[model samples]
Target: MDKLISEFDRALRTVFAPAASVRPHPDAQIDEPAMDIADKRHAAGLMRVNHCGEVCAQALYQGQALTARDPAAREALRSAAHEEVEHLAWTERRLQELGSHKSVLNPLWYAGSLAIGVTAGLVGDRWNLGFLAETERQVSAHLDAHLSKLPQADEKSRAIVRQMHADETAHAETAVALGAAPLPLPVRLAMRSMSKVMTGLSYRL
Candidate 1:
C-alpha cells in the first residue's frame, strides 16, 4: 500500500508539478532570450504538446511499473520513466521561456493514460511491452512531423524536438530488444487513431 501510495504521489507530482520546482536544464545552451513574438508563440504551442506527451509518459510508465511482475520488465519501464523526466524538463523550460501554460487538463490526461496502461498491463507483460513499443514508435514519428511544422526561426524548439525524437526512437528500439511482441495491425491502427485524437486536442486545447 505504501509503495502504491508513493507511486501515486509521484505521478501526481510529475503530471501537475509546478514548473519552477523542476531543476535547470542539463544543457543551458538554449537559454538566450529572443525578441520574436510569433516565434515565441509557435514555440509555446509546440512545447505544450511536448509537455502533454510527457504527462502521458509518466502515467503509462507508472501504471506499467506498478503492475509488472518481472523485474526486468519493471526495470525497463522505470528506465523509460527516467528518460521521460528529461523530456518533461525540456518542455517545461521551453514553455517557461515562451510564457505559455502547461495543459489545464493534465490530471485528466494522466488519469486516462494510467487507466489505459493498467488495462494493457493486466493483459500480459508481452502485450504491455508491445503497447510501449508501438506507442514510442508512433510518438517518435509524430515528433518528426512536429519538427517539420515548427517555425524555422525557432532554433531552440527545433533542437529540443530533434533530441526528443531521437530519445523516443531509442525507447522504441529498447522495448523491441526487451522482447516486445509485434502488435497486430488492428491494434496498431487503433492506437494510432486514439493518439491522433489526443494530439489534435492537445495542440490547441
Candidate 2:
C-alpha cells in the first residue's frame, strides 16, 4: 500500500509539479542567444517534444521498477528514473527560457507509457531490460534529430540535448551489460512507430 501511494504521489509530481535537478543546469554557463520570434517558437516546439518524452520516460521507469523481479534490475530502473528527473528539470527550464508551455497532452503520455512499462516488466527481467535498452537507443536517436533541427544559435537547447543523448547511450549500454536480450525486429518497429506518433503530436499539441 505504501509503495502504491508513493507511486501515485510520484505520478502527480511528475505530471504537475516543477521538477528539481541535483546537477547544475546544462546551459547555466551559456549566454541566451537572441533568437527571432520564429526561431524561438521552433525551439520551444522541439523542447516541448523533449519535455513530453522525459515525462514518458519517468513513467516508464517507475512502472518497470514497480514490477522488476530482480533486486538489481529494480535498482537500475530506479537509478535511471532519478536521472530522468534531472532531464525533466533541464528541459522544463529550457522551455521557460524559450517562453513556451509544456505539451497539454503530458498526462496522456505518462499514463500510456506507464502501462507499456508495466507490460514490459511482467515479461521477465531479460526482456524488461531489453525494452529499456531499446527505449534509450531510440531516445538517443530522437535527440540527435532534435540537435540537427534546433536553430544554429540556440546552444542552450543543444547543450541539454547533448548531455541527454550521452546519458541515454550510457543507460542503453548498462542494460545490455545487465543481460538484456535483443528484441525482435517487429517489436522494435512497433516501438518506433509509437514514438513517431508521440513526437509528431507533441511538437504542436
Candidate 3:
C-alpha cells in the first residue's frame, strides 16, 4: 500500500509539478542567441516535443519499477527514472526560455506510456529490460533528429539535446548489459509508429 501510494504521488508530481534537476542546467554557460520570431517559435515547438517525451519517460520508468520482479531490475529502472527527471527539468526550462508552453496532451501521453511500461514489466525481466532498451534507442535517434532540426543559433537547446542523447545511449547500454532480450521486429515497428503519432501531434498541440 505504501508503494502504491508513493507511485501515485510520483505520478502527480511528474505530470503536474515543475521538475527540479540536481545537475547544472546543460546550457547554463551558453548565451541565449538573438533568434527571430520564427526561429523562436520553431525551437519552442521542438522543445515542447522533447518535454513531452521526458514526461512519458517518467511514466514508463515508474510503471516498470512498480512491477519489476528482480531487485536489480527495479533498481535499474529507478536509476534511469531519476536521470529522466533531470531530463524533464532541462527540457521544461528550455521551453520556458523559448517562451512556449508544454504540450497540452502531456497527461494523456503519461497515462498511455505508464500502461505500456507495466505491460512490459509483467512480461518478465529480460523482455522488460528489452522494452526499456528499445525506448532509449528510439529516444536517442529522436534527439539526433531534433539536433538537426533545431536552429544553429539555438545552442542552448542543442546542448540540452546532446546531453540527453548521451544519457539515453548509456541507459540503453545498461539495459542490454543487464540481460535485455531483443524485441521482435514487429514490436519494434509498432513502437516506432506510436512514436511517430506522438511526435507529430506534440509538435503543434
Candidate 4:
C-alpha cells in the first residue's frame, strides 16, 4: 500500500506539478537568434521530442527506484531521477519559448517506460543498471543527432542539448562503473526499435 501510494504521488508530481531545477538552465541568459518560421517549427518539434524523452526518463527512474531491492541501487536510481527533473524543467521552458506544446501522448509514454523500468529492475541489480546504462547511452546519441539537425543559429537550444548530452554520458558512465553488464544484442536492438518508434511519434504528436 505504501509503495502504491508512493507511485501515485510520483505520478501526480510528474504529470501535474511544476518542475523545478537544481541547476540553472543551460540556455539561461543566452540570447536567442532570430528564427524563420521553418527553423522555428523544426526547433520546436525537436525540443518537444526532447521534452517527451525527459518525461519518459522520469517514469523509468522512478519505476526502477520503487522496485530496486538494493538500498544503494535504489538511492542511485532516485538520484538520477532528481537530476532528470532539471532536464524536464529545462525542456518545458524551452518548449514554451518555442511556442510549442508537449506531446499529447505523454501519459502513454510514461506508462510504457515505467513498465520497462520495472521489468528491468525485476531482473536483478546488474541487469537493472545495464538497462539504465543502455538508456543513457542511447539518449546521448540521440542528443547528438539533434545537435546536428538543429539550426546553426539556435544557440540556446544547442547549449541545452550539449549539456544534456554531457549529463547523459555521465549517467551511462556511472551505471557502467556500478557494474552494469552489457545487455544481450537482441535486447539492445529491441530497445533501439522502441526508441525509434517513440521518437517518430513524438516528433509530430
Candidate 5:
C-alpha cells in the first residue's frame, strides 16, 4: 500500500506539478537568442522531445526503485530518479522560454515507461541495471543527434543538451560499474525500436 501511494504521488508530481531542480539549469544564464521562425520551431520541437524523455525517465526510475529489493540498488535508483527530475525541470523551463508546450501524450509515455521499468525490475537487479544503462546509452545518442541538429545560434538549448548528454553518459557508466549484465541482442534491438517510435512521434506530438 505504501509503495502504491508513493508511485501514485510520483505520477501526480510528474504529470501536474511544476518541477523544481536541485541544481541550477544549464541554460538559466544564457539569454535566448532571437531565432528565425524555422530555427525556433525546430529547437522547440527538439526540446519538447527532450522534456518528454525526462518524463519517461522519471517513470522508469521510480518504478524500478519501487521494486528494487536490495537497499543499495534502491538507493541508486532513487538517486538516478532525483537527477532525472532535475533534467525534467530544466527541459520544461527551456520549453516555456522557447514558447512551446509539452507533449500532449506525456501521461501515456509515463505509463508505458513505468510498465517497462517494473517488468525489468521483476527480472532481478542486474537486469534492472542493464535496462537503465541501455536507456541512458540510447538517450545519450539521441542527445548527440539533437546537438548536431540544433541551430548554431541557439546557445542556450545547446548548453542544456550538452550537460544532459554528459549526465546520461555518467549514469550509464555508473550502472555498468554496479555490475549490470549486458542485455541480449534481441532485447537491445527491441528497446531501440521502441525508442525510435517514441522519438518520431514525440518530435511533433
Candidate 6:
C-alpha cells in the first residue's frame, strides 16, 4: 500500500509539478557555440528529442524505484530521478526559448518508459543497472551528435547540452561502479536504432 501510494504521488508530481531548472553547479563553466537560424532550428528539433528522453528518464526511475528490492539501489534510482528533474526543467526552458512545445505524446512516452523501467527492475538488479548505463551512454552520444549539428551561434543551447552531456557521462560511470552488467551487443544496437527513430520522428512530429 505504501509503495502504491508512493507511485501515485510520483505520477501526480510528474504530471502536475512545475519546475524551473536549477543548476547544482552554479559556478560551472559554460561554453556557448554560435549557430545560424537554420542550425538553430535543427538544434531545437534535436533538443525536443532530448527533452522527451528526460521525460522518459523520470518515468523510468520512478518505475524502477517502485520495485527495487535493494535499499541502496532504490536510493540510487531516486537520486537519478532527481537529476532527471533538472534535465526536464532545463529542456523545457530551452524548448520555450526556441519557440517550441514539448512532444504532443509526452504522456505516451512516459507510460511506455515506465513500463520498460519496471520490467527491467523485475528482471534483475544487474539488468536494471545495465539498462540505465545503456540509456546514459546512448544519450551522451546523441548529445555529441547534437553538438555537431547545432548552429554555431546558438551558444546557450550548446552550453546546456555540453553540461548535460558531462552529467550523463558521470551518471553512466556511477552505474558501472554500481555493478552494471554490460548489455549484449545486439541489445545495444537495437537501443541505438530505436533512439535514432525517436530522434528522427520527434524532430518534427
Give the winner by lDDT: 2
- How do the predictions measure up, each by TM-score? 0.91, 0.99, 0.99, 0.97, 0.97, 0.88
* Backbone clashes in model 1: 0
- Residue-wise lDDT of candidate 5 within 56-168, one digit each (tens)? 99999888877877777777788888888898898998888888888988999999999988888888999999888999999999999999999999999999999999999
In angstroms, the error of model 6 at 47 is 1.3
Give the runs in model 1 whose Cα sits over 4 Å from its true position. Answer: 19-27, 31-35
Tens-digit lDDT string for candidate 6 (1-205): 9978888787766645655556753213544355566776787787888888888888888888777777777777788888888887777777777777777766777888899889889988888888888999999998898888877677777777888898888888888888888999998998888777777777886
Estimate every model's Cα lDDT from 0 to 1: 0.82, 0.95, 0.95, 0.89, 0.89, 0.79
lDDT of 4 by residue, 21-113 (tens): 989999998997899989988999899889889999999998788788888788778878888889889988988898888888888999999
Instruction: List all candidate RMSDs to the true structure.
Output: 2.2, 0.6, 0.7, 1.0, 1.0, 2.7
Which pairs of residues collide in candidate 2? none
Q: What is the per-residue lDDT of model 2 for residues 5-98, given as tens digits with 9 covering 90 to 100?
A: 9999999999999999999988999999999999999999999999999999999999998889998888889989999999999999999999
Better of 2 and 4 by TM-score: 2
Residue 36 of model 3, lDDT score: 100
lDDT of 1 by residue, 15-128 (tens): 767533243454367655554887677668778988899889889988887787778888888888888888888888778877888887778889988998888888888888
Give the per-residue lDDT digits (tens) of candidate 3, residues 138-162. Answer: 9999999999999999999999999
- Clashes per candidate (backbone, < 3 Å): 0, 0, 0, 0, 0, 7
